[model samples]
Target chain A: MTEQETIGFFKCLADKSRLAILKSLMEEDMYVERLAERLGITSATVSFHLKKLEEAGAVTSRKDQYYTMYSINKPLFGVRIIDILGEKTSESEAQKEREKAYREKVIASFFEYGRLKSIPTQRKKERIVLEEIAKAFQAGREYTEREVNIIIADYHDDFCTIRRDMISEGIMTRERSIYRKAERNGGDPEPAGR
Target chain B: MKNRIEEFENYMRSSAEEKKQKIAEMVRDGRADEARAVRAGLNMYEVMTALFGAALKKTGEGEEGFSREFHILKDNVTGNWKRNLEAAEKHGDAEKVMIEESKLETVEEIVRKFDSLF
Candidate 1:
């Protein structure tokens, strides 16, 4: 079964009324009224559940005389749950694109002409801002502490907080008062002309 | 009779496949409604469990309150089946039957109880 069908099947099973209807049908093929009688629910309600069950591929109906008889759809139930749940589609990629757009929007709102207006209080917004600042440093090149401060101070007055946050968020790394953009930031750490 | 069952089965399989493909396309296009539909299906179990838990908590009033409430709710639900059967027998209008408000309220109460728990 596909994810949608799997979900529908499980959802059909979750209801007490539907379960009762299925249980009654399991013993013998029954029309709507007979099922209503057996299950002690109204025919309308039985029909309601039957419609859902039918959509879920859990039951099949047949016209017999003036009444329609319903029976279990055995093949549908035979499907593996893992197969249903394990299916992955492009929805995840779409979700990633949405998140990326939101990040860009946040950066645009908080920064003016390569300078940050203020430090964002929210961690997620702050991370985006820090990443924007990280772009000022070249990959693989080490800068003295003073050089790092000068670069960061140009973006924001509070160079100390921004600088420290960059280290904490893994946007940059510091060693022996020297700093370089993290490799994960896609910076080329090795300078040209080795 | 046998032929009809076989035909229905074939129809069901093909229709299910078609629906699956349609849903896949919807997901690829990032249709929010498709996501909501899938999520709604997945949430059924959670809703059912919450209802049952809330019902049990509500009926925990006395020594036999839990059991009594459970049976009452079961009967109320199952009783609808019987009532529908009876209505069909009398009026031949089984499809027009309605579930009682009391029973629906019980479910609503269960939902409220679940919300409180969270």
Candidate 2:
């Protein structure tokens, strides 16, 4: 984890409500309503906490038909504090700043009011756009083609092209009609073969 | 078995014809978004009606019941998105804040149009 992420992870865990939520998930995966019921909190509150936990990389959720099922990120929990402290920061601040600026420039050029104006023809720029679009997919969740299309269509009109490009570029992978965001370091691993 | 096959074929032919007519009607009514959704088989009400015609009739509210449900769902989603937006702002996560803001704006626009209609 980066310094910012380490801080975010700790800050997210420092809440009683979130800790309770994690405790509940230790038993089994539960949807928002089930979590709410178990904790005696409102569904909205449960959803809010889930969102925070998800951002903190402490919890992961998957689409289960009509509902989203949340579970603890067990691997994340296994990391020792000593390991985190021993890790060297990966990138120089200046390099990170430059990359951030380039990403923003590309996004501003291609996107208009949250919608992509057109797919970029250049391979480099297209890869950046694809990565931005990939953020819509939850890590460790598999989606049907229709579900994938619907999410991609929100960004651009030609979802087919974008979807195909995502697979071709290795940003996502598909097997037996199920789509998953490609695993990266510090990301969720692929589940054992179905 | 042949008779059943013929009956199924006829039913499917008529169903396709009916859907074409419905799409035309949607376009005529200036419901392009809904028409597009119908074309894509993503219109919530149409999908629900197709899946649960008998249950809808049993409810007796039919379309109105679905409309009320849609409104409630939209409002609940709007509430959630607003909270998410607030949280994103608090954390200063620019990308998430932008995504939430855009989503909230789209939902608000849809709600405004829905309110105007009803």
Candidate 3:
């Protein structure tokens, strides 16, 4: 099979239904109606899957009066599969360099390794407060402000200052002795997700 | 079912072998540079992704799927830069050259890995 067709085979197998349909058809040729029924899916879905397989040359179809018969295309299939599962072949060097650079950038950002805190001026007291709140919530059921403050101090010496900064930033609120995340503490009858 | 999966495996091997052969042919015909370039560009991840995408795009045998590379991902560096840098910025992201993430695998490696998983 040509490189283009081989690529197509990989693409076709990307879907579960397509894979199942292809698997089913490996047994024998079947019409759209038959395939849909056997797979417990709609005829439209059947048609869609068949179309992809057909274009990939994984299968072929022909007219049969009101029914359209579909079956696997064995020869092209063999070659395409062999190419994907076989030996190593390198891509263009120029392309590789360009792609590799892009990939590294992605990794660096993810494994930030203190790079995130590289910005010197700490304009974000919000993040600090968020960290405290997040940790407190690690209590799982969520807790009051007193508990959050205690936890913060447990983790940090400047816990009081952080708490004050957070309060000024409208992050947390003191309701009686309980500390709660300002947003989720008391919203409407409907939450944001709803 | 087992036989069909086996057949699929064989097809995958043959296709990859075919690609290697074709690249070898290019090198044999004195197009060494181009052949090397071609070899470097493909990996199992890319091949399977392309194949799966192609399959989905075919007449009615696949579903819509996209590879990792195909999806539009925000450049967080650029996003953060835009958020932070107040100075007269001369450049935006997507234009900037950046290093990619990790040690990439070849197509054969991807298939072997995938086969083991399945």
> In model 2, what lDDT does residue B69 have?
56
lDDT per residue as tens, model 3, A1-194: 43444566776777666778888888998997888799885554466567667877889888888887998887765655455667454567546655545444443332222122222134543443233333334322446666666765543455677676656666666556665556643432221111
Using lDDT as the measure, what is the rank order of every candidate, best first?
Answer: 2, 1, 3
User: A1-194 in candidate 2: lDDT tens per residue?
Assistant: 87767887998887666888999999999998999898885564567678889989999999999999999999999999999999776569647856766876898789755678899999999998888888878888989999999999889889999999999999999999999988861153221110
Query: Cα deviation of A194 in candidate 3 (Å)?
Result: 46
Per-model DockQ:
0.09, 0.02, 0.02
For model 2, the stretches where C-alpha displacement exceeds 4 angstroms are A90-194, B1-118
> Which parts of model 1 have CA positions greater than 4 angstroms off?
A1-89, A188-194, B1-118
* Weakest lDDT window of 10 consecutive positions for candidate 2 chain B: B40-49
Q: Write the per-residue lDDT of candidate 1 for residues A77-147, one digit (tens) a residue.
A: 77677766676757876577568668767976887545688999999999988887887788899999899
Q: Residue A104 deviation, candidate 2, in Å?
A: 8.0
On lDDT, the stronger of 1 and 2 is 2
Which DockQ value does candidate 1 get? 0.09
lDDT winner among the candidates?
Answer: 2
Descending-DockQ candidate ranking: 1, 2, 3
